[model samples]
Target: MGKLYGQPDRRPTAHPARPLVVDSQFSTTSVNNRVLVYQVPVNKKRPLLTISGIMSADFLPNVDPQQVMIGPAYAHPEAWVYLPLVNPSNLPRKMIVDLDHNRCDTLDAFLLRGQQRELVHLGTLFRRMPLVQRAIPVRAFALPFELAPHDSAGLLLRSRRSTGIHELTIALSTEKQFTIKRDEEESIRLVALSSAFFFMFTVFSLGLIFKHRLLIYFGLYVFPIGLGQLNYNYFFDAFPFPAWLGLNANSIGLFIIFATNCLFHTFGVAYIKSLNVYGRWHRYAVLFLVGANLIPMGLLLFPLTRTTNAMVTNASLILTTLNIGWLFYISMLGFRVKREKYLLITATLVFVPILYRTYVLDSPALSYSYFQPFYYLLLFGYLIVSLFRRELISQQMTEEKIRLVQGKLEMLRKSEIEQIGRNLHDQLGNTLASALGYLNLKEPRIQVARDMILDAINETRVISHNLVKDDNRPLDEKLEDLAERFNDFSTISFAYSDYTEKRINQLPLLKQQGIYLIVQEVLNNVVKHSQAKEVTIQAFLSEDVVRVSIEDDGIGYTPNQPTSGIGMANMYKRAELARLKLSIDGSVSGTSVTIETPLGG
Candidate 1:
């Protein structure tokens, strides 16, 4: 139990303990297990420190401890350094580990101290860190070390580095200041909370509204994007799903993100009310995005080789960059077509920081600081914009419907006025003229004048009754009247067939009105243009749908041939407002028009 200080003047005893097994879960091979112990002498004197820079990886397997003290230092790409310290006083000690690697790939620190059971456990000197936007962290760290029989035990630290020329600073001190904590990581919880809020907002918007296509697609897109942040930010580390979801979780998140990108591009190009604006080129771009999204599946099938890694990297780089470029292009299109400047600007402002955070400054650890405020705010903006657009489109549809309904009412008023004008000009005027003739002829025929007066009175009563009535006339009665009035010496006959009483009354009021107007226009077309001798109107109900059709036996024109008169346009517009599907078929033999509408509450 004799001890030597300042250096390892005593080789390890035969009963000395071996080093503990280093945990390497993902590694393919085993490591050499050799433990070295050194004893430092106690002194009320100044502290001691020893520092060395490693020049090559070869130095680790075979090392001359004496030669290591005298080796010349040269500036090189990667250095594995050995730093040892001896605390020789009967008090607590402190150490600082300062590393600077601008082009860093990986840094592993092993801090070893001796134990009675024949193994040494490494102290966690530094948490796992990944280079984010900043190439190098601008801070250093101070850590505490304690040992039993406090004065004479030493600590050993081995650092392996893989980077260009860099510096390492290890110091032994008696102070209590540690500067390893970063200000950015402190608010990690806040960022996570913000992400959660945005994520829930997207879900709420999706569940609340289905009136717009943008909302549906945008909601779907937000799902993978938000979860990807949580997953990459290490939020899932505490969750049980990651045990089974490991690796596959990341893979699936990436797949969904890619698919959402494709969907967003597609929906962005051709969304509600803007379907006519997206052309063949836009469709082709959407197809290209879909193909791009499928690239991640390749990782599942192949054992990754150098070529596969290169391919995957290229695909990811291309698609990720293209997502931004595609959005910019859409913004330009939106400005021209929809004047959606806020949509583009807010999106760009919101997403640019996200791009920097995601693509530039990704950390290996799920540190709270990994979640950025801009990413969450950007997502919130998207949700707001989607809902805003949905609301605008809904209002537009409602107003259009109101305008169409107003037109229908106006058309109904005009028809009634025209019929009243015809009755007064022909029937009532003729009867009054006959009464005047009975008096002017000097016949003094009181009974004949009385008869004419009664007829005139009845005509006035019918006109007044038709004008004041608000209830609907039966379809059959209206058709009979239309036939009698338009019968030019029996030149044309009206044939009408309708659904049963139960089904007919089940039709909505607006739907019935639309059908009646549409039929009236069809009969008028037959009279004015078809030279038709017979016109037939039919209606029926089938499978929760109500259908109305009109047919004529005369010369017929093609259906939807743009040159059709204003009456046809009115019928088409009315049918649209009523949510009815309309079609017309015309040929030399005859013409037929039909409309079908769903029954609704």
Candidate 2:
């Protein structure tokens, strides 16, 4: 008998139990027991393949067959299965048999319940053969056959031909593919944008700490938390770290976030408590939250024992929840206080969505990507508002100080005017009256007496006129007049220099009077107290300020020694009123009083 082989044209048939078959022709030959394998391609484009057992040798009647097999079997566009045959004898034998195929798609259909039933296709195939034929397209086919002993062959035949026949089976399933929807992608994009915005805002907010130091210390703590939250979400996926390291980073980051939140909360609580908005209980609550949140961070660093992962998560949740509740409470309190309403409203609006996203929605996309940035922005806004308010308060304080100084100066001016009036009436007026009475008394040198009396009267008149004059005259003119008047004494030599006419004229009348008084007092002290031989008054002006120096060549008196008069005290008081600075530098050689006043004054 020729080699028992079928042509390559064996069309594939769709049979649920046996979807593919290549039956061998009967051959009685003394050929060595050889097994032939067939390569069949299973179609994946159709349905999944369900494969089962091989036909037994006993299933063929009056045939001395070895064993039957199929494969280099390949299942397609999805998977592949291999079928093999074994021979007991060295001689090859082939048996005639009819290859049965059946469409058994409903094999497990009865077993499915409820929703599983929907997996079945709605339509039926017109031709079963086309399904299988389309499934396996390869041409080359072979089957393994083996010779068996008569007893074994007869047993296999009986088993195969029995009423209860067994068959190989396999189940196949198609996987459903899913794609991201537009809204999902949009959400992701929004999250990314929000995260980036907050990250930048956090950086700017942190910068404010340096720009506005003491006032923005709160921002220093707050910005770091914002950054931590941003980094935790945005960088986690992209960070090139090991799993444990990533988790550690995340834990540390979250620790910072909670820590900052606690810091801000505690600060807020303390600040509000200071305003008497909340009771001591509110402060205690803040302290408790702060302590709880800090425990993990402290443990993470050193000395303290490290917190367990579970404890950290639990503590963070508790702290966050309490903080959110407290924030709402404080906001309500703020509304009642009627002050800081804007801050309260802004913080509430900014943080509520974040809290909801965090605890309620549990959306990372919302928390890190969107809410964090918005939070930072709101924090920055708060800082700006705080700074502006602080500046306004500072300005008001400065104005109040200025007003107080002005009132004191006005009082001093009134007192000085009264004292000057008293001195002119008691000293100069009385001296002139005595000189007039002496002139009226007749004497042998009545002419000489009349001349002396006339001189004294003129002197008194000059003093009266000088006192009444604007005294707004240039410093040089004033100093010249003073020097000439002092020169009349003959014993005193007065000299002056380095005077700017325009600068002296530009000085405020009160400030000029201050300088003039300081000069006059120094001269009087030198002439009377120091018994000075010569006196020199010098004035100089620079772009920003003026300097007046009055030097008397006299025996210098030690500073702090109680003077025989109130000249020094009066000078100091006048300088204070005019806001001028005075320094008396003196020694045995001379006494120099240097007075500095702002030029425009």
Candidate 3:
């Protein structure tokens, strides 16, 4: 027989509402197959003892009466009943039975001999049953049984003592050996979805590291919402966790939703501000809300921390309201700023469904799954517009800088032309006039001297003409002119080939002049020092580049040998001005100077 204990009641004399009272009872029974079930019934509730029941061995219609024996009672009218049954004969036949709701609250089958009343708690249920006479404790709110001819006997459930109506129903059974477990399909799907979410989040994070704004925002704000939806569905539909964990499908969903929304708020502010739109007050509000949510998240990590469930719920509701309000505010601001109407409209449309699902509608049809993809799409559209705006602004700035530089270059070019004209008029003209005057004097002995003076005047005239003419022309034409003039002094042979005429025609004037001057210097060196039989000038033009090679089969000088000369230095300076790549190779066979320039066009 079970005993009962009473404790002093503490309560206010007058109460605003009626208090609920609970009464509970326990009994046990054993069937022929060595199965024991201790059934407890709490005051008449259909969902009995709140602890899941255990299976009996005989495949009885109800809790077996013969194997049951009464044990001790606890402090609050709680009772313990024991039922013991062995294996072997208990199996080979699957049994289905239903228990009376009013009598049996919960059933706990156990193998231990000692009874401890203090062990019974509201949230914990314990059961012990034997499999092939081997005892094991099963702890859960509910348990399913599959007993075979050769299998061991095990307890089906453990129940906490409580006053409620508990009814038992056999959920499933099969003659064929249990091949596949229940919830397996749903578990696999949930895992697959979780893995996908993890991958997408990782990708988003990497994109953020690289400063990809679209992917960053997508991962930060959008992907989490999808993950939240998946979590909500997964927890509710399959693989339900412990109630003590305080992580229900709804709680996880709300947490993810609020957190992701907070991120969106932050990113949105920055995104708008970058577009020269103001979002100051909204940003501050979002920051405050984010702080509030973070406190709850921190608290959740510790084991057995008293959950501020109401606070978390309230915070979630507030955040959702604030997010909706901010969305509307941003839409108004977008209108004032004349932002992209389609993007604004799309965002508004997307938000409407989420808002409706969250607040106005309770149906699963209005779930987050329907709206998440659309939200990401709207975000992508906004990102594209932002990128286009940035690119346009950058292009305008570049154009302005180019125009300023072009103006300065034009001024410099005009000044250079004016300076060159003055130098020619003041110096070369005076020298040529004096030479002409000397040539005009008549005398037989002085005639030879006069001829020499006339030749000098002619040479000076040609030089003056070249100095004044536009230096922009084909490099070959310039080099050919130099070779012709040099031929007047010494016999010159030129061999030029393997270059496209079309490319030569496209050389910029400045680059052409630089190459011409370099060739002229090389020819002058050949005349002054190299007693050569032939000279070879080759010019080649490739896409966006020009190469000129001038070679003479004459005495070559080693570059390492010391010399006091400005000719090579001047050639290098001309190359720098034209931005030409120059290389000179000299050997006993010949000396070759190669000048290369990249065509700007």
Give the whole-model CA lDDT for all candidates, comma-separated.
0.50, 0.47, 0.48
What's each prediction's TM-score?
A: 0.45, 0.33, 0.34
- Candidate 1 lDDT by residue in tens digits, 1-601: 1110012343323332232221211111111122231211111111212221222222332123211111101112233434433344444444433332212223344443443222243333232332232223332222344433343333344433221112233333322233323343335644665665565466547546646556555556665556655544444323444343223321343344455566566457645235246677777777787777676544523444434433443455457567777877776677677666755775577666655644444311111223554355465556557646666777789789889788876885676577568778777999999888887776678789889988787667555544533348765465445555555333578777767444665566777767766776676567657878788777777787777778888888777477523567677777876778999999998898888877541
After superposition, candidate 2 runs with Cα above 4 Å error: 1-215, 236-247, 266-285, 299-307, 353-601
Q: What number of clashing residue pairs does each candidate have, in the order they appear?
A: 3, 17, 25
* Cα-lDDT of candidate 1: 0.50
TM-score of 2: 0.33
Local distance difference test, candidate 3? 0.48
| Candidates 1 and 3 compared by TM-score, better number | 1
Better of 1 and 2 by TM-score: 1
**Could you give candidate 2's per-residue lDDT for residues 459-503 as a string of tens digits?**
454444335454557665776677676666436688877656556
Shift of residue 176 alpha carbon in model 3, Å? 14
Worst 10 residues of 1 by lDDT: 66-75
Candidate 3 lDDT by residue in tens digits, 1-601: 0111111122123211111111111012213123233333223222323222322231222232221211111111133322221234433534221121111234444322112211222222222222222221211122223334533332333433221112222222231221132244235445556554665576477556656564466466656655654653333323455756654432455456557766776556655664564557755776786776676555443321212543453455556567667767665676576554544565667667766744453221123332245345446445544654554567679679668756754654565466446645654566556656666777334565565566555545444444545455566666666666565656557555546574765666666766776776677567646778788888787776777888889888576666444457667776776678999888999888888877552
Model 3: residue 43 alpha-carbon error in angstroms? 15
After superposition, the stretches of candidate 3 with alpha carbons farther than 4 Å from their true spots are: 1-215, 226-254, 302-307, 361-601
RMSD of each: 17.3, 27.9, 22.9
